[model samples]
Target: MKDENIKTAARLLLGTGLIFAGISHLTFARKDFKAQVPDWVPLKIDDTVVYSGIAEITLGGALVLAPKKYKATTGKIAAAFFTAIFPGNISQYVNKRSAFGLDTDGKRFARLFFQPVLVYWALKSTGNVK
Candidate 1:
């Protein structure tokens, strides 16, 4: 397959994952998500989760439906979004908060490695990266 086809497939997959995760954030998994919120965040944990949920939904939809002409810009925004959320992941690790089966120090530490992958995925999947 061609590179563009791969990118399109990746973009769709990332968008779907985000949509599912966003829904979970607002619904069944909300309480669990709160565990990931950093103590340093100024807002209430619940509020932070809700706002991030909304952001995920919006960004995911954009990734799925954005015109080809705007893919790069959308990808840039998505990458930035991923960067913005790195703190929560770090908090989850640093605070040793257990959620989503990341109960052990090794698991939590390993999970930290995935953030940059997500950021790269967002950029590469939308043609923002060469």
Candidate 2:
């Protein structure tokens, strides 16, 4: 029961964070987010940011509201979403784009490691892992 409670709290926290991030992507952080978009992506940087923002909002809502039966599936999807955006983190590091105060190469490199943690968070928070 305690473990369940912990998972619940973690899930809620992750969901809320994602929602906030999504909003920032569409508004205040839009420009900053563009710095992460890889040059290889065909879409305009703005469009990619907007689309990803929308996705984050949707996934966040799912994580927050999904029923027990759906939580695992939602977690899996969220993990995939995190994985999908990983290249953007890589782009920020490789291209030397400074945003979110990741001005130093070491900082950007460190940020890359956080993506996997997010994936694990999504899974573990939803009880996808023991």
In the range 1-130, model 1's lDDT, one tens digit per residue, is: 5999999999999988898899999999998899999998999999999999999998899999989999999889989998999988899999999999999999999999999999999999998789
Tens digits of per-residue lDDT, candidate 2, 81-125, equal 999999999999999999999999999999999999999999999
Model 1: ten consecutive residues of lowest lDDT? 15-24
Worst window of 10 by summed lDDT in candidate 2:
12-21
Candidate number with greatest TM-score: 2
Candidate 1 ranges with C-alpha deviation above 4 Å:
none
What lDDT would each prediction earn against the true structure?
0.92, 0.96
Backbone clashes under 3 angstroms, per model = 0, 0
